[model samples]
Target: MTQLKQIKLIAFDLDGTLVDSAPDLALAINAMLVDLGRSEFSEQTIRHWVGNGAEVLIKRALSGTSVIAEDLDEALYLKAKPLFNRHYSERLCVASKLYQGVGESLAALAELNIPMAIVTNKPGLFTQPLLEQLNLARYFDVVLSGDSLARKKPDPLPLQHLVEHYQLNIDQLLMVGDSKNDIQAAKAAGCASLGLTYGYNYGEDIALSGPEFVADSLETLVELMNGSVTA
Candidate 1:
């Protein structure tokens, strides 16, 4: 594997790797459920259901647990999606917070003049507002949301788009995220991936997804990058 310093373009998964947006997501989901006259889900439940994107999260919320896409109630999902989007837009950063070392790690990477991009399963409507509200909009050179393309993570479409657009070699980029979708997408796109141990992986360990590197804190990532740069 190429060292982090050798990687020129860094693509990140927004929700778990960069910020802990689960609290805000939970609030929106609960409100949408209440509007639909359904019971609210706890943050813990919602957090595990998040990496798949808002639509899947809502489907899981409405169905009360893990659900196959084909098994979703189309009518209920159609009714609930708009409600969730509206509420999430209003509460974008109410309880969302940057994880420890995120700002520093980003800053260190920026100081190295590495171009960064964000590839998230979040839809553009919610993604833009959340990034703006959290002041994270400045760090990314490119932002690909769930709706930006026909396919999202675990499919590799988003990252492949970046590689083509930036004229980047697969080995020249590093995909950093907190879920299996991220690693799967990276591997499919032929890029190296780094997984965050503390981030949500649908109630599983991130290492099981087979990222090239795994760390519990972004500080550790910065250390790896710095060491590689100096070595």
Candidate 2:
């Protein structure tokens, strides 16, 4: 294991990392499919499609597969996007909840006076309402959604923007998330990252992403953040 270091601003990916929003997203996607007279997807299938954003989720759900092709019909995709958004807005948080120990970990971080932010591929509309419903909004000083900027995760724009706006040292920031995009963004932005094994990794092992640490649970992540784990 790499040596753990002191962290200042801890940025998180919202959907898979902090909140298990797959249920709600599945509900909405299946509803859209049913409306279109297409087959509905299973919750487990939807779970694998998440973390890439709603548009990607919608595409994956509608196609009945996770594989995306560039030659897909733009007209049909544009038509389906709004339907998914509408259904999702109504069903947001109906089944979503904070992952185990998430609330406690956030509170503990607050008590320690550590700054935090949400950096997720979820759109602002869904992210804000879901966090508000889960009562997790107050824990973050900043919430950078997928649509917040022109580029999303894997581009390093969000992390760069956060580091610049908050006047934080790049090395002092840590990215906690559950997918390749998160790890890539952290690496591109010159920050350390911790991956959650329990979160969505799109059927791939998170270890291949090369996060500095891989935590089995939020409690374990809190321990690492609190310096309980020896470097």
Candidate 3:
């Protein structure tokens, strides 16, 4: 557990960590593909293409494989981006849902009076909508989308922004997410990270990223954080 006694603030990643957003994302991806006169892949296939923001998600969908095509047409990509956005906005909460125990877990954390925020690479437009749709918006004090800052995850700017916003040392913040981007950002920001096993991690295990703790569910996380020293 590495004895995470110094954690003062917790920053969560939106897409994978809290919500299983792949089904709706796949619908949006397939809609974009159909617009471009291409065949669509299954939700499972599209699930692996997530983790990065919508731009890369569209790029991977256009490539039709895990490895994004090197020859994707720039103009065509420009067309696909807006198409995906429109389609995603329409079905923002259609098949998307909060992962099990998210609400109760967040409430548990709140009971501890721990400050929390959301730091995600999902775009600003889609991020808040999804949270409000799932009723998860009330739990966070700060929400930073990909476009909210100069840079997003894997760059540490989002986490760094949180560290600055709360007036805490970076080490006192703990990041919780399912992707390497989250862990990488936390490591770069000199904070602790808790990796979840259930979210999209590009078909690889989140534990491979070497977070301070790897959990299969958020229920345990409440226990993990509740038992840790806050003072």
Candidate 4:
């Protein structure tokens, strides 16, 4: 087994790893689809479409349907974005819940005084509300969203900005996420990454993303971060 190193700052992806937000997102997307006179998608399909932010999600939800055009309709997507946001705000906590042990793990990390931030592809509007709903907002020192920066994950800009903003040593930072975008961003920004087995990976196995470690559960992640787990 690879030896785990001491970590100082921990960054997390919000949607899949921290919260099971698919249900609320699915509900919002389906509501838009219904308004457009289009059929709704299953929760599983919406799960795969998440992690790329709201516009991409709307694109995926409208895929293979007449309501969506071949050429990317900026106007249509923009119009739909606010509708999704409005619907989601009402349904945010109706179905979304933290994965088991997430709250406890976060509390443990907080006790350690480890600086934490959220680096997610989710837009700030929905991300803020959802985190507030789950009661996880106070745990994060910084919340970097897709709309917060000029570029999103897989581009490394977000992580790079975070490292510079925090004045952190790359080796002391750990990025915890559930997808290749997270892995790629962490790698490019020269931070260690831990992938969660349960998050969305867009059909690819997360192991193939070459993260430094794979966390089976949030509890296991807390143990590893606290140095309770030996190599």
Candidate 5:
């Protein structure tokens, strides 16, 4: 793994990396499904469907396991979108929480005078409120939600934009996340990546995705940052 001294800017993927939001997301998704007279998916199912953003998650929920978005009926998506948004708005963070060591890690990073940003595929509507309620809003220099850009993670648009915003070289950036989208986005943006083993990865191992490092808790990252030479 690269030393933390090389990381001038650290970008985090929201849902599974910094926080565990699956429970809340599942509640809203199920509420929408029930409103549509469809069977509700389990929380485990919803967790697997997340990371691609709300639209894709809803589409996957409507289509079931491993189904492509094209398989989802457009009419159902159009109907479910509003319902899901409304439900999620109400349930945001009711059951969600920062993962172990998230607060401490964020504090440690802030103490290091490092600039950090959140690059999440979650819609801005839910993202802002969740961050605010969880008291995580102050930790980030910027927050780029899925709706903030025409494209999100796995596309590199957000990371590229952050590089421009910070006026930093891509080599000086690190992406910390829970899924392959984060790694793919980091690679495409020419940045290093760290993956979390405990976060959702479509039920697969994050290591298989080839991130520079993998750990189960943010405390490990804090340790790295503390041990690394100052940037």
Candidate 6:
């Protein structure tokens, strides 16, 4: 693994990175499908469709595949969106859980006085609640949801915002996630990225994303960044 360059700010991706929200998301999606008189999908299938955003997750569910059809019916999508939102809102924390070592690792980092933030593609409506429910919100001062800015990950705007807001040099920010989207965004923003092997990455290997570092557990981060996400 390449050593991280003097990280002063660490930005985490929610959903797969910190919390395993698939069970709840799958349940809500199935509820929406049932309401729409459609067939319900399994949670495992739904897991492959996560990490993008709620809108795209719905699109994938409506289309029944990760590769959403360009000709997906907008009218049906219009109806499904609110249905999903309502269904999800009702069970936001029912089946969701923070990944193993997440809470402890975060607390460890907090003790180290490392400034942190969250830059997830999940919308603020869902993102904030999930964090609060899991008690992860206290670890971050700046939380940038998908809609917080005009652009989300893979666009680099959100991560860039963290750099600007924290007044840190581009090299001082570390974007940690489980998707190519996170690694891509960090590369675009000229920062470092750490990819986790256990999170949702479209069922692909996180190593393929070519991050500066890769670890199977969030605990490794606490070890790697004893005082820094650096050498």
Q: lDDT per model, in order? A: 0.88, 0.87, 0.89, 0.84, 0.89, 0.91
Alpha-carbon error at 86 in model 2, in Å? 1.3
Error of 3 at 178 (Å): 0.5
Question: What value of lDDT does candidate 3 attain over all alpha carbons?
Answer: 0.89
Candidate 4: clashing pairs of residues = none
List ranges where model 2 is wrong by over 4 Å: 1-5
Off by over 4 Å in 6: 1-5, 227-231
Writing each residue's lDDT as its tens digit, candidate 4 over 49-161 gives 88878778887777743234578667767777778878887887899889888999999989988889999998887788888878999999999999999999988888888
The sequence of per-residue lDDT tens digits that candidate 2 reaches over residues 1-231 is 433456789999988899898898899888888887888878998899988888888888767788976677777778788888999999997888888999999999899788899999999888888888899989998999999999999889999999998888899889999899999999999999998887888988888999988887777767776678756
List all candidate RMSDs to the true structure.
1.8, 1.4, 2.0, 2.2, 2.0, 1.6
lDDT of 5 at 108: 90
Against the correct fold, how does model 2 do in TM-score?
A: 0.96
- Which ten-residue region of model 3 has the weakest summed lDDT? 222-231
Better of 1 and 3 by lDDT: 3
Clash counts for the predictions, in order = 0, 0, 0, 0, 0, 0
The TM-score obtained by model 1 is 0.95
Q: Residue 217 deviation, candidate 6, in Å? A: 0.7
lDDT of 6 by residue, 81-137 (tens): 999999999999998998999999999989989999999989889888888888888
Model 1: worst 10 consecutive residues (lDDT sum): 222-231
User: Global CA lDDT of candidate 1, please?
Assistant: 0.88
> Local error of candidate 1 at 20, Å?
0.7
Best-to-worst order by lDDT is: 6, 5, 3, 1, 2, 4
Task: Show where candidate 3 strays beyond 4 Å.
Answer: 228-231
Better of 3 and 4 by lDDT: 3
The digit string of per-residue lDDT tens for model 1 on 140-179 reads 9899999999999999999999989899788888899999
Each candidate structure's TM-score, on Cα atoms with residue i matched to residue i, is 0.95, 0.96, 0.96, 0.93, 0.95, 0.96
